[model samples]
Target: MDNKAVEALTEAEAKAELAQLAGALAQANILYHGQDAPGISDSEYDALKQRNALIEARFPKLKRPDSPSEQVGAAPSEGFAKVTHVVRMLSLSNAFDGDDIIEFDERIRRYLGLGDVAPLEYTAEPKIDGLSLSLRYEAGKLIHAATRGDGAVGENVTTNARTIAERVAEGRKLPDIPLLIDGAPDVLEVRGEVYMSHADFADLNTRQVARSDKQFANPRNAAAGSLRQLDSAVTRRRPLRFFAYAWGELSAPLSDTQMGAIERLNDFGFQINPLTALCDGPAGMLAHYDKIEQLRAALGYDIDGVVYKVNDLSLQGRLGFRSTTPRWAIAHKFPAELAWTHLEAIEIQVGRTGALSPVARLQPVTVGGVVVSNATLHNQDYITGLDSKGQEIRGGKDIREGDWVQVYRAGDVIPKVANVDLSKRPEGSAVYVFPDKCPECGSPAIREDGDAVHRCTGGLICPAQAVEKLKHFVGRAAFDIEGLGAKQVEQFYLDGWVKEPSDIFTLGERFSSGLQQLKNREGWGEKSANKLFQAIEEKRNIPFARVLFSLGIRHVGEQASNLITRNYTSWPALITAMDAAAACEGVEWDNLLGIDGVGDVMARSLVMAFAPGPERDSIDKLTGHLNIEDAEHPDIDGSPVAGKIVVFTGTLEKMTRAEAKARAEALGAKVSGSVSAKTDLLVAGPGAGSKAKKAADLGIETIDEDGWLQLIDGL
Candidate 1:
């Protein structure tokens, strides 16, 4: 919401924005993947995702459990039978510019411990803008085809896929996908993209207009809808094509390198991209990318960007993967298109944090094949033609109503006003004025020092803030009550059925027996009402971390919740600790701060939230109706340092501080940043300061880097 650059965000601001981003992205995934319709442009979605990544990079410890960075696509549509992938179909990280590509190559080299001079080859190819499909074959015969639906599971479209293969076979040419291949592995799963050529897409639309059906927005959408049709007859009529670029599960190794593997797939009667080439390094990769970009317009189908992967299969194996993406590969996207549009008006929307975010209403214009009617104004600073630091931007040209502005969606996924045209500005136009009062609740909007945007002083009194908070409470990362979505939350709030989270638990008990029953409400029936009540009842017992995050406390994100709960183990323990730490000094405060990644700012926020007040009262009321489970402990049966509170002081020589902490945590150890009375072991390195002296004074066991390594050796 605050366009004040990712670098300017404090830990608290980043955490809050991350929560909002997670929810938005979750909805986007459902629209794009599950429903075969996207509400936002690809550039807009990419911008939001890129912003999420940037924030997480700056505040790694604040990364939420439901962070969009850890997710891919959406759950499979209910219409299709589910197919669980043998190997998860992960996505690739994106590189927007040449610098990003350079950093990507450098990161891979660093991860694999390869020198700059080392011959680390890479394979570069076009990144197809289409639906991902996995075709599984056994004994050289096509077994099934599945669409990538949320990475781990997919939608089975075997019948629809077979129709395409059959049609290709009837053409009397080499089939795009041979129903049977010779000399293939006993089991093979080829991964590719299903796309429609521009000419074919035009023809399909013409047919759709003749049939009086809804016209598709783009070729990608048309191809997806056609392939995912329940009736294979519908799919057989559509001009769909496949380009094999990767693999999923294999009975044996296809080749020693990525390019070789693609060649092998081609030999097995799959249509491989002819442009796929081996690049010597980053330079060659970029060169090939440029060539591909020049050829993109004439390629007949859609390609959003160029993909680069570690060519050597062994190197790729060594690079491994993150939670939802391969570490060895990245997509270098082409630059976004630019267009000019009129700034019709600006509207302010308040967030759950009470920050007033401005949105730009624009005259609808097409940019990059998508119609854009709106853009993000970010904040008052962005609208006023200055950054948070009071520096001039757009040559100090402030945005005004009735002005023509240049719009672009390159770095940021959200279309932004890049520049204002002074010559085209209306004669009567005046500089835009930001509001000093909450637009929704008439509360006084105040801007704090060092903050970029204005926040409403009103807490729950503001309907906008209250509704957003309620939505967050029922978010996928929080309580996650089934059948309780954002729309339901808003409807219930407007009807005054649910005001606070605790009120939700008592909805059935009070409303079900009253004259104004939920069953009789508009668009509701007894069965649906009963199902909603049952879903709400099921969430009465929730995990401790979810409970903490569900409260929507400032500076407390999913990771912070996990860290605090893991330390205290139970709700009562955390409450007791917070009560003690409210004094702001002593062992309690130190203990709270000692938790790795929990800074003074976050500690203060936790203490304030738990102090006696309306916030604490609400939390108490909510907890009364629910069973709060203890924090889950990792399986540490064979771990040497399980349940031990370990601290690292000064510097770590063998590994980075973060790496050391991660390794220690993997072995079931609590890696604290500061040394406290509860510290079981201290791994002190060079320049060990007050922390080392305190550990000695407390008579805690201290060890050097070598000793620490020796202790965990062979574990």
Candidate 2:
């Protein structure tokens, strides 16, 4: 229990403990950061960590500065602002096979005074796929957010920090527990992951496609992209959520045990994994790990493995950290989900939303970490053989369901029929015919002009549209009603608790008592319910621009929203204008021509939404329930780049480059692309490159960033 025991540790015992710490910490780091899996549950890993920390405390002479117990992940990144991590983020070790597991157990036995009879415990939970970010809260406001760059210093991303505000607020999520610290108006750095929702990722990709922008490979990439935007406004538009699991700096100790700490974090608003549990000892830990293995398919998001941490902080200190990781934790990875099956046939299906998706039928294969015989093909052009005649070649289906098919996860998810063996096709199999009617709503499917996608005009009455619309209405981009997550929205719609956006505002009034029941749930209480209600109230007042975008009108984006807002002046004005415009027999060509980017298709779509029915009624009803932002001209009068494409190629002496660009955008300059004959003037600096050269080549005069600043001052 103290130093005397450690002083008497046999040479083998000392080596064993240190080795255990090294392997465990390394593995945990890999599982959690690299692969998104943990071999041990957070609680179990915490206990092991505490044990190591205690061991180190008793033997200060033997302590290593690089010990997992002492170190955090890495330093701050360079692109964004810098935030010093008050509490160092430690790394973890992991194990990929059973032999490593046995080795872990062997070291555990050697370190502790007890032999075979003294058992160890391990808890397990899914390792979520995400970016590790630390949030610092001063009082209840999120002041700083940083990434676990190497584990120590990190770039300051406060603007992006504001986007994940709900994750660190004590009123929203309880601060990490079992933390030892000092003070009031405390500053606590909460460690967690920022992830993009699957649906949101899809929508983002779709938008990117429409804009002719590059799409991210996965949600993790999407999250990173959103988090690193130079503009906080961009981050706010992203659907990034956080889940807390570790600690950095803390002014006070949170809980007695690791599980207790997580519970407290949940109390504070950090999303702790609900699947975590306490196991008796090593035997129990392994059993729980098996239990998780069984539930692998149902846990919604992607997970690489499970993490186990020692539970008690006091005991964790006894165990101590290695140079790279803590001895207390480990990650148990699930085997890759994969299968091979005959590609029965490839068919293209038109979705409710006009997306032309391809589907492949397989000879019932076990692929979903379970059995899945079918997978989506994504598009029509992916299935058939293209003809030189400028049409799809007939009689050559390219893929037939009865043929040999290679099945694998496309990006480790959404089982895909990767390739087909042409020789194995059944005799006389025919090419797939694209459907002309909606499968779910029975409406005639028609492809839009100048597009390959076939869309059904089912509107709001369609089942798919109904659910999707409700989700969009309550989404982070819209009303952001706290208690109404997507799943709850579906349940409410199905239960008739809500029929539209208005229905969401009425839930508290319609069934406040039922919500109180939610308070009694494992993680909720009266305080939580009240807090959720407060969050809802805070977001009740809507931004007409955001409301318009949230309506899911095709072709409308943030830029479009800005344009709409600039033109309408008020919600009523916007509505009236839309209605009047829609009533006209053709394009309001003269008025439409005034807007720079307004095109025929977008104009027509706007008319369609305003032509009115349920969508119109919903808009009117929503106005009655919420406050809209006051009509005002956007405040962009004095900033330097207000009306110019003033590119800063070199460092600025007046301010940091960030501040300079920010100031430039603040002015009326139309910050443009490459300068040309049309360029009014070029804001060139010391490092000005091709743009400045081109400006000179084009007879456009160039000014240093400072000279430009002076010009803006005059403006």
Candidate 3:
């Protein structure tokens, strides 16, 4: 669907579009985070996410449980052993312009309840465009290293990390990530980006071609792939570098402020970004961002933006975190880089949701040091010189097949066509026509009432949709079957050997019985076939959350599935609850809506999926071949409020409502917005109203703000 201004969207429209945005953002995360390749330009991704956030703000109840606004990177790739971070590696929210940075500062000040002209210090530094790595040291000795996988769990690349500090650069010995340090804390986890210099990347790619290996697309991908290598020797020869920017787990405080902490890290033999500096306020932050953008080309490494963090450590503690990002920080991305390239052709690609997305094939041209051969055409309206609202763009000039176009990559990942050079259009070149049928299945494609893009009506019959769904089922965040990736999924779907999620489980049985002779297939050997079968078999007994996420239901994603499964615990229970809630009115429906994040729209989607239908039949068939584990609960053993449903009401004096909620959650309490029969405790502040009275009527334990604070004192 085309993005409309948030204010223009009705509640219903906002709800529908939010679902589409959630799915798009989720797929983008998988490509960028799990596969180290991004299919959409950074600007496009940010726009979609920003739109989702705006819509959520306008219609708060429409926010989906798996809303992109609350999600971080995709789950870690399954190639390496997973490491659960002691403290989460959160992602930063983005800002595109100086106005956004100013608003960001204003928001921080307001959240901290500061006056309009409050002096709040901030630290600004270059945001490196490379892999995020966290190094752990215990008892002053280097212990292990991890890559930020899904913020919570990461990939263990300890051996490979040890090689980063062994290199020399610019006639100076690079600081080693010291194996041991004197007077260091009992535990420390330094977080930073592992990058490859532009020179090193070129040399490595040259060597790769000489060795008959595939050349990397860019330095970021090259650095990530090298550092994640199973063999440390491979990493040792890659000339990878590190710059410590933040910390994860710390046994003690580094300093009282962000800049001081960085200086402390530098004192302990870690390279700090030389341009990192303290900014007085929003103006200073913007100035530093501009300075970094100017110095970007000379940095010898990839940097897409500048990061700003509130300098005061105490203020940061009060600001706390949102679901996925910290309120105390944001990344102000540099503006898009523009370059002219030939509009070779436009190709329509069908997505799993049946949306026909247009891609611009271009003659390769370098934009910001990366080759740009493809750009997003957005939709039919975009190509026809009109936006989603039928407003003229590019001065009402249509993009033709042979026109020279301007492409831009805002964050140096994916490039998109921004403008067309009408004067350079080839004579007799035709204005491109978007397809009226699905390219893969020849089904009738129709644009919906409020959507911008055309969608195929073929449903499960559409090969593109079916294949994509099957791919998602086996994706890293889902079944994650080894040796079975997108390529394999497509191949299998075309071979008529796998049609649905259930078809995968029966592969081993069918092939073994000669329904298909796997060993004789072109790229298949007996050992490989057995290994594929073994991998599929291993995933039969999967977690409930994965099973739900693998189904590819509308509006249901990893977080949504986890939220549902955590509340329901098991497959049978969830199915039963959904069945009861399908009627849309009852205690069951209320309870489903009461699951904290699940709203009416999401609840209805779940109910429809579980009701008596083709989808449910398919789900049942898939479940028949596997063992589904119950949801795993978080460990809150030592907290006083563990498992308690706590409610905070009225205006808090010491902390903002957001901060109070975060603190309560951290202490193992389930913070609810309203008081209910299930509420165990109520923390009422000044001006407590109906909720406070309701808690008192329910005979729940009631406490003032000081009493609430004292209850969890020193614990």
Candidate 4:
């Protein structure tokens, strides 16, 4: 968002923007924190957060309780057991410049009631751009290990840690961490970063390419994914290194100062960063930061910034912490690296939802040690130099091919176009025009109000959209046919063998009947064709939720589809409800709307989709060829919330709305966004508005989060 647009936003607009920001950040947290894969670049995520904080400062009262500021990383995934931290693993607030570092020191001094001239000592260390890990030792034996997930709780990876230790014990030397510290205290929690060196990362990527596994985007992600493996053998095989810099839940104090403690840790056989140093004041800290910045490329591992913390443990205690971060420490981050490159061409790609996304093909240039050839345009507005709110950006200057564009890789993630240098514009260059028609089908591409995307109107007719939908059907989260991938899906669609969701199941039968010969084509052999056919046959008995998601309806994502399927349970039940709801507004429609996360918009989209038309006809045709299994309720014996429809309303004090919903869903409850008669429980907190009143009038059971805890505890 631009400054002009930010300044001109109304209270309502700000609230809407905040909600959107919260949702996007939450999804990013899930992808990055829970799944160990990030969907957005660090710069994009940081920009959204900065925008959210600024808007909140301007309109504090309009801030939602589920604001990103109040949350840490996402809730832990179900793959591992949850470990509640003895001391909350806090995240650090960031500083972008030398002035911010000076301010941090000033604040620390003021907090300690010390004079500005007094020498406030500090320890400056490279802020490792990797996964945070806490290793707990009881009686000098490593007992517990976890990732820093959401601060309060983390995923238990003790087995994985022990496997690494066992491998190290077998005459194999890993990186310099002491898996078994001899002189450690009775109860010591050694907190540090788990990172992959440049050489290790390159070797791992080479192996990934050889094995046909998905390559990690960066060293940080590689380290995280490697460490979080459920199977300890996998973690043991990875080239992982640990650097201890902090402590948690200690039985005894290591030293009087932070730098002294780090030294003690090194003496105790932990690998301490050689770059970590004691600084007298801000000048020393800033100099060390600059020194680290200069040495960053040669360091062999990623360090996005330098962290400065008060040396004296007592002074640090005096400074204390804010809600999420400590006031005694700050991370002074490095500026993003940008390089100028020529834009070769602009291409539009169609998404599964039919939205057209533009990509910039740039002349390959090195940015932050990575080769950059393409960057996302986000939408047509970005290409036209307009913000999503249609406000002027970069003085309304449009980017064109052959322009010298600045491309930057933030946190060594996705490369993006930062700016275009118009001074070197080519002769006869004109403003690039986005296509008005769909490139694949020549259909009118229209942009709806309040949406930043332009979508093709030809839903089924457009080959791009149809092929994308087919690919989604066979996606890892969907049918997951092993031999049939994007290439096969496109080829099948082009060959007129598969055009819709149902056509996939008929491919084997058609080939058996001599109607289509798949083995005759290039890239298709007898064994591969048979494997593809067998894979298609295996997906014939699919679950209801996956089938719903495979249909490619807008606003109905995997989670939403799961909720809908769990509520209806069967294909016949869902069809009956949708058919009844489409005819008129009644109990069936209200119940459909009543599903906890189903809002009016989602309900309308679903109902309209299931109404008599191509969509309904396609679904009906698809179901006829397969046995759609009923959604199975999770096995939560004696749980009070099992199979219940729950609606959470108002500002939950103990947890965010997302947290409450995620928790409820984990316990086998349907979390509806709105309250309705079908809702079995109403979780109302302070400031609950109409939903609370509606629930009360409907005689639904109402309870607060504390009551929720009591109910789950009783179970």
Candidate 3 lDDT, tens digit per residue, 395-419? Answer: 9888878889998754323456779
Model 4 TM-score relative to the real fold: 0.66
Q: Which is superior by lDDT, 1 or 3?
A: 1
Which lDDT tens digits does candidate 4 get at residues 580-692? 99999598888886675565666777888899999889988988988889999887887788888888888877655655665676687877777777789998889889999
Flag clash pairs in model 4.
596-671, 596-672, 596-673, 597-672, 597-673
* True lDDT of residue 701, candidate 4: 96
lDDT of 2 by residue, 552-582 (tens): 6655544456556655557877776677787
Top model number, lDDT:
1
Candidate that would win on TM-score = 3
In terms of lDDT, model 1 sits at 0.83
In model 2, the Cα lDDT at residue 652 comes to 56
What is the overall TM-score of model 2 with all chains considered together?
A: 0.45
Order the candidates by lDDT, highest first — what do you get? 1, 3, 4, 2
**For each candidate, what TM-score against the reference?**
0.83, 0.45, 0.88, 0.66
Which 10-residue window in model 2 sums to the lowest lDDT? 176-185
- Which residue runs of candidate 2 sit more than 4 Å off their true CA positions? 1-356, 361-375, 387-397, 406-418, 426-431, 508-537, 566-569, 583-597, 631-710, 713-715
State the C-alpha lDDT per candidate. 0.83, 0.59, 0.81, 0.78
lDDT of 1 by residue, 111-180 (tens): 6666799888889999988899999999999999999998988999999998778766333377677799
- How far in Å is the alpha carbon of 471 misplaced in model 1? 1.9
